[model samples]
Target chain A: MTGTVWDRGEPRLAGPDTALRAELRTAAQHASGNVPVAVATDTAGQVLEGMRGRAFDSAAVVAVLDGDRLRGLVTLERLLAAPAATPLGEIMDDAPPVVAPSTAQERAAWLAVQHAEPTLAVVDDAGRFAGLVAAPTLLGVLLEEHDEDMARLGGFLGTAATARSSTTEPVLRRLSHRLPWLLLGLAGALLAAVIVGSFEEQLGQEVLIAYFVPGVVYMADAVGTQTEALVIRGLSLGIGVRRIAVREVVTGVLLGAFLGGLALPLVWALWGRADVAVAVALALLAASSIASLIALALPWLFHRFGKDPAFGSGPLATVIQDVLTVAIYLLVATAVVL
Target chain B: MTGTVWDRGEPRLAGPDTALRAELRTAAQHASGNVPVAVATDTAGQVLEGMRGRAFDSAAVVAVLDGDRLRGLVTLERLLAAPAATPLGEIMDDAPPVVAPSTAQERAAWLAVQHAEPTLAVVDDAGRFAGLVAAPTLLGVLLEEHDEDMARLGGFLGTAATARSSTTEPVLRRLSHRLPWLLLGLAGALLAAVIVGSFEEQLGQEVLIAYFVPGVVYMADAVGTQTEALVIRGLSLGIGVRRIAVREVVTGVLLGAFLGGLALPLVWALWGRADVAVAVALALLAASSIASLIALALPWLFHRFGKDPAFGSGPLATVIQDVLTVAIYLLVATAVVL
Candidate 1:
């Protein structure tokens, strides 16, 4: 329960545990069926008399059904305002949104919110009434999904599983949860060293070339992280990667040019080496442009594979940017300065 | 609306724009006053009659008002099942959760969700009923706030404001939104170079020292980012930084030791230099521990200042960790290798 709380909430509708292709049937399990219901032909007097004999869970809305098929819905307020002799059909909202059990849970929630309905009707494949997803459950799912997205982007493996437990979980459990990504980071760090070692001759000839290694990598990472954040969020909001691809590429190049343009003068003034400054500027330009593309592509690729797009963000992306930036900086430096 | 789309909703009750110190009065703006009301002495029939005459904004529940004082709340479902002659005072929920106008909006939302109430009642400082915040508005605010948190953590300067526009924003607008942070990153990159420049002698004496710069800094940033994400999220969930401080410190040390342990033998095996390997390991240990502390402290400090805790995450935290990591690596390298 401590490590796997999300699975307890109705597997398919629950946020973090939801598969990439989860549907409304999974979410319907979380819906509350404990509501008042009446036959579509029932009059207000008959419904009121039946209601008096039965205990209700949440009486926010009363469903009017024809056999097992949902016919209409009557909000408690509307029901109360109706005269006793009025038939339920005369006052019920005949067009309340109904979702098939196979609909995507996110789409279902979106539709519910857009219609300003506190509850959503879930119907079976044959259009029979299934149940209602109450406002509280939808709110919980939305909030849980938000947390899961952030956790995935943050690159913590078990952190999403233990999200609620993070605050009060024991220290050992916290350590255990965060260690998986840090271990992956270790492998990336080693690869970064191997990449730098490939340019050892350049470093030996001009030691100053090594000084800007962190600078170039950090800038590239800064730019990349921004794009990854944007892309991940955009994907969740239903915007496709192709829509923002061109603008991001242009921004990346422009950002690179502007940042590199400023750094050229600064490096030249500080180091008194024109070749080194040129190398730094060119590397920055290359790294920035490459980082943005990588950031955009990684998330898009993950999504294309039916994975959470957030899986492509955070430490994994940062390490990839770092290795590339170092290789780019050293290669450009060796060519220009050595 | 182009830049300040968030303001289109009520200023105070909306999510992202709320200041850290914001109180209940702001959230009350989202509350609807269009509910059936009775003087507590009125019967269900009178309340029902009154409800039918008005155009209600939200009819989830009825507020029993006794001379502007919130006497009790009668949910629509409860009212429907009650006999017409039952007095409002006898059938209403006498102790529904009520908050003063100064209650924090987030707290109010939490209370509403916890109580499974579709709306929240806000009372003034002197206990007069302000209004009832409907479910739709609260749900919208929560989702908006969640998006803002993610945007801030992702390091895009105007991304939170332009969240909905990220996919569709023009190239220039995207550049403008991202440049402010990248500019700050540029400054930090320059400082990282300066820090590396200060270690010129050690790097010149042994060029291999420069090879691990990116590796060490990258690892530190990776570690720091995990802490930053955790601290930012924890703060938002009302978990105080001090509560998790000790565990985080210990976790950082353990993680550093583990990563450094694995790294030491690898560096020695690849480079065949024990001094260099030892320096790398020790530097990793020191940098990792320091990065974790900085990550935890920055977000806590930002939150304490009534600023968004997310401001302490992303590129800002990463850059700060980079500077310290580089400084720590070189200082240890100079001591061990030279």
Candidate 2:
């Protein structure tokens, strides 16, 4: 037996020669009871009739092949609106989305994102039909990478199939998969601690400054995450959303202006230092909102570069946002308050 | 002649029947040269022969239906190791993921984050297949809601599709859709800033304390953003992670420790106060990391609670993190410097 490279410990590929019809027949022949029906395709005429009479739902699709060569497919959905006299080709979407064998998993994921479809047309290196990949499968890869433990958490699903693949990974494997990320996070924390301590004289001068640290950081994080989420969601859903990506910046600016409006008064009210509040809020709001726009900009850039946007999260967005945020904060404080 | 009530501005439906097949044909007809291939079900033998011959790109899938109801679907990727003679019913995965009509745009956007092959089988009210929704269409809805005024500034997609619907409407519609959320954030920011600023007397007692505010806040934001990015990405990917949402908290603690270590060394090196440096670094690291974790944790919590995680970002995460961060910073400063 060949060693299967499993995704989430479930075999992702069976073998090239696997056939469902024969397997089903054999399963039916070998065992008894509750045999599933064979799904078939419908021609345009048949589909139309089915729809006209409202039986299209019962119809599946089949490829009307000529011997062993080329042919078109017929499905009830396409058939319903298809003219009774029209041939399958005339009504068929002649060119379909295709995937190649040499295509990287990430590439397939890119196709899934670009086509805005959950599935892709998979072809071999020779441009031959290989197999199709659905969006969920691609998503599964991401989830598997996210948490060895989340596979057990059932991440927004109720199915045993996905559940099994997600949750069945052994503890050791799960730990191995996730531990590195946690360790990296630990390292990041250390770096941050050092930066803060290095500036102790500055902090020691202002105890009140310490109280705002968590809130400012949290706010910036929230802004960055939200902006990133929006842009990514936009990118994932709309393949050519470079236009939307830019708009995110504008939205961020507006959000900053609005947030600044609220933050300024409150900061002043809380500290009874109107000048400090105005200065800090103006800078903070601008940083927070703009950070989100910048954070969200990556998905489009990654796509333009033929990279996977979903794979990046904690590594860059956080670091960049933090550095810029600090610069803006200090600058604003110096220019306005100091 | 009828409008597409569901999307509001879909290209005109080509025909009358609202049935899935009819609707798809209508869209296809309207699209003409732009019409892509139609994806439909294929019997087991057809699938085998197709793959063996390298026919169509494995972009299309074979959906298994039981009397108009979706049983499961098989994609090209699934066929690689599948038995050559199996019936699709035997191999088809039943209970595939689905999307309901009433699902929010944000939720739909989030769902698009699946890494595996994912498809949303649009079903009619009867739970029968209506049509397939590609991810782009869903994301387009949100992008369309975005504000765009200038081409260079990202106001439009530069596609003629916008001509189909009056831009004035979506913009106006957004006022209602987005204003409330912005207001909520504003209120939160205002309230927090006011409460915090009221402590001006304490800060005035030590003007130096104000100088550290910006630096400490930026550190927290940086950590929080990273955490938020991870969680957002994980959720979008459908990773079954659960404990990590909480377990991630440990990331802050560990980070704090590292930062504290550095802070102690740096402080002693810079100011010749080993104890103050050590204490402040420890305090800053702990507070900073905690702020980062909270920034991340809150969005997931909001998403889990059925709110848009994007909407969850702006005020709440920052306000809460800052509040806690400030308290921590104040405590540390008073204990050591005051």
DockQ of each: 0.42, 0.10
The 0-to-1 C-alpha lDDT of every candidate, in the order given, reads 0.75, 0.43
Q: Measured by TM-score, how close is model 2 to the native structure?
A: 0.52
Task: Write candidate 1's Cα lDDT for A130-165 as tens digits.
Answer: 777766666666666666667776767733563446
Runs of candidate 2 with Cα error greater than 4 angstroms are: A1-73, A76-87, A94-222, A237-242, A264-274, A284-293, A296-315, B1-259, B284-318
Writing each residue's lDDT as its tens digit, candidate 2 over A123-240 gives 4444433334433445543333223212211112211133223233443433343334434443444444445444455545543444444344445655555445344434433334
TM-score of chain A of each: 0.76, 0.57
For model 1 chain A, the run of ten residues with the poorest summed lDDT: A1-10
Best by DockQ: 1
Q: Say which docking band candidate 1 falls in.
A: acceptable
Screening candidate 1 with a backbone cut-off below 3 angstroms (N, C-alpha, C), the clashing residue pairs are B31-B133
Number of clashes found in candidate 2 = 91
